[model samples]
Target: MDAAARDAQGGLEWRVTVPEGATVKVEHEHGAVARAWAWLLACMVMVRSTVAGFAKRVWKIAVDDPRKAVHGLKVGLALALVSVVFYTRPLYDGVGGAAAIWAIMTVVVVFEYTVGGSVYKCFNRAVATASAGVLALGVHWVASKTGELEPVILSGSLFLLAAAATFSRFIPTVKARFDYGVTIFILTYSLVAVSGYRVDELAALAQQRLSTIAIGIFICLAVCVLICPVWAGQELHLLTTRNMEKLAAAVEGCVEDYFAEEPARPAQVKSDGYKCVLNSKASEDAQANLARWEPAHGQFGFRHPYSHYAKIGAAMRGCAYCVEALNSCVGAEVQAPEHVKRLLCDVCTRVGTQCARVLREASSSVATMVSSKTLDFAVADMNTAVHELQGEMRTLPSMLTVKLAETTSLMDTMPLFTVASLLVEISARIDGVIDAADALATLANFKQVDNDDDDKKRETEMKVHPLNESDTDDEASPENQITKV
Candidate 1:
């Protein structure tokens, strides 16, 4: 049934219509043999796709983080062991069925990338669980002893325990690392104590929970440490090295973007150059902390000199600050005078390239845990480049001063002045970075010092500059900031 009507604007509108007898028909007309062949072909196609999809997904997961596969395997094995022990009559009767659940949770909580972190967490969790179980048993016994004080004893004990645990979390030292353990302790205590009120087997329940958690922790520790273990320190060192490379790349990119005669490309902004350096600070800090928790092994000893890691981090921040300033000077909003642009281009070609190259060397050197003499040469070249940039910047003020003297109004010269100021600031920041690099080199024992006073003086000068607060921190000292190269 089709119909036409006049629209509001006085135009005829045709409406979609289906005939009364019209039907959507999907008919299969293949003969018996042909239909069987079609069905077989469709099944083959579906099977092939399913298999391919499964294989592709497996590859993707493995490629993303091969360690993830290892972790998964470890978890599975730990859980399986718990299940096997739980199903066996003797073991299951000895500990209680609930022991298996606690064992599973232990495996979930104790696994960490570094053996040190895992062990540390395992110990903390095991101790916390044991302590909580004991306390819950004591609370249950005390409540049972009281004739009419069961509710009061249980509720009041919970309130006190909850308040104390919550207060401990607010303590700065505990909150950073052990907060999770504290939270689990509180939860386990509450569950055990509260649930024990109805169940007559409070002691048995507590014992089972503690035993299961202990077993799980032991399994995780053994598997993580003895197997293909990954060290957080190694990861941290690698991250630091990568960040160095990223920092160098960022500097070069920012220099190119700022001075290029052509318009900035969309792809340029999205590249790893700027974003990598910009987002590195917090990630690097966290990784370093995790690394610190890792036990000394391989190249690292009990007295592993990880303090140098802090120095390298600070140096990266110094480099990052300069790079960020350079990044800010990009885009159509800012423009420099023709002569100033030429000067910048020349500086970038000479100094910026050297910075990136040196940083790349430093990154490699750090990863290898070896000091390179090349950093000294890089520092020398960087010094020359900095001086050259300083000379170019000095000319700007002279030129601007002349213009200001000749013309009463400073408006025309202000934009160029701002550009010159940024260049000068950039030079100043590079000066700090150079000093930081030297400091880093010295701390890594790569650079021998007859007298530390000279390095100290240079660092003092860097600290005076107000380009950023990174240089003012105690760790911003020359020794606290370093790179391998």
Candidate 2:
């Protein structure tokens, strides 16, 4: 009986231990499988998110400027045209397979967004390739006659020419206009010089390369100019005009913000307008450089005053700097008394308004390519306001000295004074902008504004908003009437 009970208990214990072990093993396997599935899901989600983000960015880029898409299409078209050389047996036989590759390479390197940029690159590539080929052939001939000294002559000539071309890039004019050409000169010369040592048919090789490259350049130029051509000169002109408008908005915003009854929120100030002007030097220089390469197009002549755009940009930037300073003053912690601000408010508003008017007129002149006869009147009005501002400034010291003697420190008044001074400086800089615009008009032969048309426009405006008796009296005022030249 005792032995039977012990065996029964042992069996039960064995059964319990085996099943428990098996359950634990099963659970472990299930956990691992779940974990593997979770990891895969996470990876799939990440990949999906990444792809969505990439697509969003690409869409944004395409939408923001459809020109980019057009440019891409143009490039694709050029590549396809050049690829025809490879597919055609007769053409391939003429240039050979290796030379045909040069055409494809030329399209890739020489195609640019603007017609000016494309022309610049194409001309540079063609000239550099031809010049290098001719010179390399000459060197090859000379080296061939030198017998054992052939290698030495070729190496020395390559070294000197490459060094000279590289050094020429440091020149300001060369660096600005012909830097790409110089770079191509170095590349072509080096390749030809080095290859000539091993290649027996050097002349034929050079000729094939030149012809193939010319074919590529012609295709690129034709595509760039003939299909939705973007002229750098027109772009530069528009950019200058837009910048002037931005500057005007900034000037007006700055003045209004400074004199507001309540201090302006940071978001209320239109700083981006002026900030753009500050950052546009690089774009201006690049566009101007490219514009020089563009031929006559639209209203622009072959010798259109693209350089004057630079001068206008410079003048606009000078005003922007002053506006920046005024902005700082407006946002300063030191506050001037309300009454003190009121003292200068009328004259300051006049000055700011007149300054902005002058900028707008100048901008309009550039945009329309029409010389404004009334621009002189606007400048004179701005000057008169500036004089009024100076008079107001002259009176501020005594008024502040008396009124603020017991109430506030002199440091508190400095912000207002600084703002006033900046406005004056900005007005002076605006004169520079006017002069630059005038210079552009003269050089570009901008159409003169017709006095009769102006008179008719004014008459139409008066008829639309007929002047009251008081308005007529104001217009008759000696201070209000401006002599039109």
Candidate 3:
């Protein structure tokens, strides 16, 4: 016989009594309720962790750029202003629920973070909507006149207009500025053409949509321009200036790391700092395009030669490429001998430092909106450093011939040669950057520094007080030293 009984621990146990008084007991497994509780606990933990992580990311974003938070609020304000149309009786009657939906949709689509971006999209949407509506009305009139071929006429018009608009998107100039407009044109045209077939009040429908969308666009533009406006022109100017500084820092860092007694570790190499310049082309182009839509704001005037920034960025990237190659030399496995590096160390460092100084001065000129006379001086110093480097290079063969004496392989010297050559090329590229910056200054009417008087006074002082040997030595530091070998 088998019987069920509760054990001392209060768990269910099954006991079987056999002949000769032998007994066996089986413990009960846990019930489904316990498993359900465990699963529920796991789900709670996962949900809690997911929520915490999402909140952390949101907080980080909001903190990193408070402008993003402000932009969000501006968007909300625009939406709220447009939503009043639905609540007011007159507006509700004029713009029906169906049309009011378009107003809301327009606000959502047209409101951008930057004032220029919002203006660009709003203008595009309005013009595209108006143009498409008028064209649709004309096509509808023609289709109605032809009774038998009405459907054919409508379909043909749709095909031709849609094809033309889509093809226009492939054009570079059109795609950059008017791509959004073309897309909206196609959507508005298709809606009116297809719906006009079934509905008699096509003109009223188109008018309601156009008027409401215009209202939405007006509200969006007002909010974007008035509420803590972020100007694309200013952003682009700052970005270009910041990139120049980064280029300078990258050049300095690369040279420093390369000539360090120990080879740069992977971590040091990874943080080369030139990556920002390499990846900034897209952002620069986008900002330049949007900036053209903005009116005069802050230091940037109307039609403020924003295109010159693209040229400057291109020149910076060219220099950045050389810096990247120089960085690679820092980690090369086959290094030049200690003596070979020592031979060119002072000249290389001097040239690199001067290149960085030139970049920094150019960047400062751009940032301050001043045509810096000091920038000319910096360029002159850079040129002198380059001459000194060339002089060192001329003596390098003879010096290496004596020191190496068939002891060093070609592979061992290649890294040093690459670093030296890149530094020289980088110095050449700095001239392009300087030229672009100068052009921008000229076009933008940057404030010119009057330093002739200061220069003459300094020259007079220098002529009166001659430098002693100690003073000459102090002035002829490693950076100012002209090395022959």
lDDT of each: 0.65, 0.83, 0.83
- Candidate 1 per-residue lDDT, tens place, 344-441, comes to 46654455665666676667666665565445545555555656666755675575566544543335434444444554554455455455545645
Q: Per-residue lDDT for 166-247 in model 2, tens only? A: 9999999999989999999889888888884444588888888888998999999999999999999888988999999999
lDDT of 1 at 47: 100
- Of candidate 2, the 10-residue stretch with the lowest lDDT total is 465-474
Q: How accurate is candidate 3 locally (lDDT)?
A: 0.83
All candidates in order of lDDT, best leading: 2, 3, 1
Itemize residue pairs with steric clashes in candidate 2: none
| TM agreement with the true structure for every prediction | 0.71, 0.86, 0.86
Which is the better candidate, 1 or 2, if ranked by lDDT? 2
Q: Give the TM-score of candidate 3.
A: 0.86
